[model samples]
Target: MTSNSDTPASGFLPPRWFIRAAWKTHKALYRWSGGRFGLRTPRPDRYGLAYLTTVGRRSGVDRSVMIGYFEDGDGIVTMAMNGWGAPEPAWWLNLQAQPEATLDLAGGTTVPVVGRRAEGEERDRLWERWRELDDGLDGYAARRPTETAVVVLDPRTD
Candidate 1:
C-alpha cells in the first residue's frame, strides 16, 4: 500500500489493539513480578522503560503507566505518543494538567519530577535523538493526526 506524509505505513507496526494489549501485558508483568520486570535502562542508542505516576486532572487520583524514555542531562525525555495512535496518551494529558509526578525506574529507584513540553531547538534535538533510537520514528509519528509532544521530566528537588 502506498503511504504519504499523512498516512503511515501499516505493516511496519502491529495493529493498534495488539499494541495496546502488549502494553497492558507489560504492566501486568511489572505488577506480577513485584516490579522486578518490564523496565530497563537506556543504552547509548536505545530508550529505557519506566513507570510514571501522574495525578488525574478530574478524578484527583494518581494514575500510572509505563513509558519509554532516555536520560538527557539531568532530565528524562519521552514522547507523548499513544502507541503511535492519533490521540494523545492519557498519561501525557494528566501530566499537562499536573506536572508534578513520580518516575519509578529499574532497581527500585523512584524520582520525583515535573513534566513539561520541550520546545523549539530542544524539541528538535530530543526528537532527533528518538529518531536515532527507532528507525521507524518518522513513519510512526506520521500516524498521529497532530504533532507529538516531546515531554521533559526534570527531577524535582522539593
Candidate 2:
C-alpha cells in the first residue's frame, strides 16, 4: 500500500458506503432513463457503459450490472474492480461460473458474449489501455489485495 499526494494515504478504497450508494444511484438512473444516463453510451471522453446480464451461480437467475468498458479489437474489455476494491465483484464470479452472457449497449443492442480473462502480456496491454484512460488505475488497483481481473467479452459465434 503505497501512499502519496496522488493516492490515498491509507491505501484504502473509497468508502464502501459511498461506493454502494453511488452504485445504487447509477443503476437506478440507468434503468429509469433506459440507459441514457448513468454510465451509458459512448461518450466523447469516456469509453462507454453497458448493462451486463449473467446467470447467477447459485440462484440460477439473471443478475445485471452497469459497467464501464472499452472496445478491444472485436471484443469489449472491462475490469472487475467491484468499486469497494478488496472484495471481488459478484458479477465477475458469476461470469466465471458461466461465461455466456448478454451485453446491452446503451439500451440499443443486446449481444451475446463469452467472457474470458486476459492474461500475462494481454492483461498488461489491456491494463495499460485503462491507465491511459484513468490516471488512478494503479492506485485503485493497489487498494485491492488480489490482482484485478481484466475481462474480455467476445461476441458469441454460435
Candidate 3:
C-alpha cells in the first residue's frame, strides 16, 4: 500500500492518529447530540451541523459526510474540504461526477440540493462571504496552493 507521503501533497493526508482521533470525536459527538437532541452536531460553530450524502463516483455507494454550511441567498453553500490546507475533498469530486446530492440539516430537514461548481465572480463572492463568517478560512486559504472552488447547493423545490 502506498503511504500518505506518496500521495499528492495537495490532498488531505492527516496522520493516522489524527484521523482516528477526529473520527472518534466525531462519532461520540454525533451519538451524544443525536441521543440528546435528536440532531447530529459535528460542527456546532458557524451553524454547521448538516450531513451531505453523495453518490460515490466509482464505488456507486452513497457516502455521507458532516460539513460546514452557509446560506447563500436562497441556496446553501458548503466548503468541499478541510480548512487545514488540503486539496479539494473527495466529496467535491463526487459532486462533480454527480451533482445531485441529499442534504440533511440539523433541524431534521432533508432536502435534495443540486450541486453546482462555482467559479469566477460567484466563487470569489462566496469565498469572501465564507471568510467573513469564519476567519479560520483565511488561514486555510493561505495553506492551499490552488484556489478552492465553492460548491453551491441550490435547494430543489420539487
Candidate 4:
C-alpha cells in the first residue's frame, strides 16, 4: 500500500479477516514448531509474539490470544485494540476483571504476570515506544471510536 507524507498506515488497517488469519497462523506455527519458525515479525512492526492466557470474566473459563508485545522493564507491553478496531478485545476485558495471567513467550517460556493499564507519564512513555515500532500506530488507533488501551503484563510475584 502506498503512503503519503500526511498519512501513516496509508489510512487503513489490513482487513480483519487477514489479521485474524495471520494471528492464527502465527500461533499455530509457534506452537507446532516450538519456536523453530514464526517466532516474531521484525519488519513493518516488531512484536515479540506471545500467548496471553486470561480467565474469562463471565464465562469463568480461560481465554488465550496471540498478541504482539514489546519489552518494558521486567514486563511486556501490548495494545488492546481489536483487529477491526471498535469494541475492546475480550482478553483486555477479561484482564480488567482479573489482572493475573500467564504469558508464553514464543511458546517457549511462560511467565505469570499481572496485567494493568498504563497511566499518566508511564502510559505516554509506552505509547512513544510503540510509535517507534510502528509508524502507523496513530492511524490504526484513530480507527477506533474510543481510546485504545495499553496493557502492561507485569511479572507476577508469588
Which has the better lDDT: candidate 1, or candidate 3? 1
The runs of at least 3 residues in candidate 4 whose Cα sits more than 4 Å from the true structure, single-residue gaps closed, are 1-9, 34-36, 41-45
Model 3: residues >4 Å from true position, as ranges? 1-20, 31-45, 83-85
Instruction: Assess candidate 2 and give its lDDT.
Output: 0.84
Colliding pairs, model 2: none
Error of 2 at 86 (Å): 1.0
The lDDT of each candidate is: 0.91, 0.84, 0.70, 0.83
Candidate 1, which ten residues in sequence have the lowest lDDT sum? 2-11
lDDT of 3: 0.70
Error of 1 at 127 (Å): 0.6
Per residue, candidate 2 scores C-alpha lDDT tens digits across 1-158 of 33645454333455788988888888888789876776556554567888899999999899999888999878999999899468889999999999999998865788899999999999999998887777677777877889999999999989
Better of 2 and 3 by lDDT: 2
Model 4 over residues 35-149: C-alpha lDDT tens digits? 5665553343566777889999999899888888998779799999888468899999999999999988753678999999999999999999988887888888877898889
RMSD of 1: 2.7
Q: What is the TM-score of each candidate against the true structure?
A: 0.93, 0.88, 0.74, 0.85
Q: Which candidate is the best by lDDT?
A: 1
Score candidate 2 by TM-score against the native: 0.88
